[model samples]
Target: MIKTSTQNELIQYVYDELAKNASEQLETAFMHDEELAESCSELLQIQNLLDNALKSPHKRAVQNILNYSKSLSLQS
Candidate 1:
């Protein structure tokens, strides 16, 4: 199994959130490791699919969450 940190790094890398240095590091790793390259490829495909499927939360859902937060704040 891949380390959690590596998986998180791959996710951030796909989203262009990784640091330049880390990105370069991962790039070098991917070049040397076929598995890492494949993992990155799969993560990128999933990221694209998610980007295409993006949508705003429903108004009611947002309102419900806000209301829940207010209730929790009152309890605190």
Candidate 2:
């Protein structure tokens, strides 16, 4: 099993948040450890998915906000 700290490092590495030295060390570990390398690959895939995921509010949510604003304005 991977250590918790190493798992955290994997996340940081995936996000490009790891320090240069630490990143190099992790890469070195990756060459010898297939599990660690696979974990990193999975994280990269998830990060890519999140980066491309829909970011806007739902249409219903926007309409609800607009309706609430109109109601408040009518009371004022």
Candidate 3:
């Protein structure tokens, strides 16, 4: 069973959002708490997938916007 402290620590650890000391503590807890480690791994995977998705061409249209703006500028 994972302790509440470990569960809470997972939130920051999974995303690498904790300070160095806290992150180290969380990693130690993760090594000892199977449930917490699994939860953190899942969250980390999901976050990584989401980050990759955001970087996909369909997810970001900045280039299209810039091209359109350039065309408009040329017309004006």
**Could you say which candidate leads in lDDT?**
2
Query: Which ten contiguous residues of candidate 1 have the minimum total lDDT?
Result: 1-10
Error of 3 at 39 (Å): 0.8
TM-score of each: 0.64, 0.70, 0.59
Q: Model 2: per-residue lDDT, tens digit, 1-76?
A: 9999999999999889999999999999999999999999999998889889968989999999999999999999
The local distance difference test score of each candidate is: 0.92, 0.96, 0.78
**What does candidate 3's lDDT look like per residue over 1-76, in tens digits?**
7678767767777767778998887778778778777888888899889888864466358788888999999999
Off by over 4 Å in 1: 54-76
Q: Taking the tens digit of each residue's C-alpha lDDT, what string does model 1 give over 1-76?
A: 6789998999999989999999999999998888889999998888889889988988999999999999999999
Query: Model 2: runs farther than 4 Å from truth?
Result: 56-76
Give the Cα error of residue 8 in candidate 3, in Å.
3.3
Candidate 2 shows a clash count of 0
Cα RMSD (Å) per model? 6.4, 4.4, 3.8
Provide the global lDDT of candidate 1 against the true structure.
Answer: 0.92
Report how far off residue 23 is in candidate 1 (Å): 0.4
